[model samples]
Target: MDAGAAIWEYLGADAPVADLPAMGYGEVASGYATTHSAESVGIIGGGYVGIETAEAFAEHGLDVHLFEMVPHTLQPFGAEAAATVEDHLRKQGIDLHLDTAVEGIDGAGSVERIGTGDHTVPVDLALVGVGVAPNTELAEAAGIELGTTGAIANDRYGQTNDDQVYTARDCAEATHTVTGEPDHVPLALTANRAGRAIGATLAGDPTPIGEIAGTAAVKAFDLEVARTGVIDEESAAEAGFDPVSVTITAQSRAHYYPGGEEIQITLVADRESERVLGASMVGREGVAKRIDTVAAALHAEMTVHQLSYLDLAYAPSFSPVWDPVLTATKVLHGKVAG
Candidate 1:
């Protein structure tokens, strides 16, 4: 499949910072190569790739400046989650320029600086992590239908507009499990799973590409951030659910355990139906695995009541008697039950 391109069109014609000597490390592929060294690097966009790259560059001792056009990074995770991450990023000395627009990239021969309206940041290297869209030029040229998300239109079996042609990976549109609507999550797992299903289809064994929950996890500094399903209240309500959410800071392990840490979990559920919608979690430990449990719950359509009583395994070294996931669900179950 023609997955996608690293260069966002607005970043300029074919080459990103084409005339500049700056580097572009792709979220997927190594976007643009770099041979030059730099003391300072400017990262454009503060979404997943941008933030992760910024953290990496910062760790390598580069003065990192991350610019986001939005008021906050990780807007999909909402303000609270974004703030939690932004605070950590700030603590690590990442220069965050939120709600700032890049006026232009200016330099004599290579990128010397990037200008936001109020300030001009001198950057030795400029890395653009502005995100990517589906590579549908070939799909479009072949008269294939594109979904609302601009990815190639496909069915559960991954057949495109032309039955003989198929689309998978980042280029294909997927249906969200919660809303049962067309979505383009473009995550590695989604791409890999969809690709497998398409392979089965081509082999005469039609396997359904399951609905996506938009489950994902990323590590930002000391934080393990994970999110899944319909965590957005507005989106849940729009999907005909009366969404109610509860956020709690709970211990990742037994309180008396030596390695215990605080894990913040935000659980979303339907007030009327009592079914769990989604969850957002972040912590220094025990977050990544816990988020997978919620993803399973989402797949099973488990209610907060069900999730609260999941009978998960627990040990002081691993989790508390009531796992953080359980604590979050139990708390949400109370609100929904009430």
Candidate 2:
């Protein structure tokens, strides 16, 4: 399929029966060929999309090259959490080039090389999943207002500046569920939540949005990495809190349980309030499930003490009586206390 068709499928649209945009696999076949030849692939931008794509491509027998202009992947996730992701990526043979930018992608109508200052790689394909901008040309010509981020400036309920205007997905901003800041977070979950908020308001119930607590996860190369809330240091400070972090390396299931795996978890909290802020986990085991538990705790404004004592279900086949998250919480609580 062509790029447009691929995008349509991604958005869950039915395939065009009559006229489908034809992709030149022959004309553009060089890009695909380069991908097949190179053992290593480089991803620019270490956000959720970049990281997830890197993991997927690496698993398919390609040497994954990940490039991030920031100091680490997942800039919103802060340094400590990014480190856990990096560790997981490294285990999968992904080469992370952080604090670097791709000068350009060079190829003859297909990607053959990725160019950087003083560096060049004969890449099979240069996956430029460096995030995206609002496809707002239609909105602009129609005179819709735009946010500073180039997204549509929607109200708490997803209503744009115009009375009849509503926006979601990559086209709108959302209120931070914790900090109450209006932010343009291009996540599907945010779009859905904002849609609901808009629906409620349209139904005559004016719902207010809280601060956006960014949430994302990735399952790549059999490793699960997930994070939520403000995981970055600057974000915490911007939200008027001093941040403290703790990392825990623990078993996924009971040690006695067969096939149990190891997981690394990191929790970020306010140094003064001891309130849970953001967290991340990485493992070939049950990292996503565990990170979700912490994500829930952060969303509900639960403190470390509360999360530590959460009445979580347990079984040796799935989890220990005290899950890794509970243990991490207990660890964080101790740090907060003493």
Model-by-model lDDT, in order?
A: 0.82, 0.73
Q: After superposition, how far is residue 143 of candidate 1 from its true place, in Å?
A: 1.1
Mark the regions of model 2 whose C-alpha exceeds 4 Å error after superposition. Answer: 1-27, 30-40, 107-110, 137-150, 203-212
- What is the model-wide C-alpha lDDT for candidate 1? 0.82
Tens digits of per-residue lDDT, candidate 2, 266-322, equal 888887888898887777878776677876887788888888888988899888778
* The best candidate in terms of lDDT: 1
Residue-level lDDT tens digits of model 1 in 249-327: 9998898989788898889998888888888888899887788899899889888888888889988999899898988
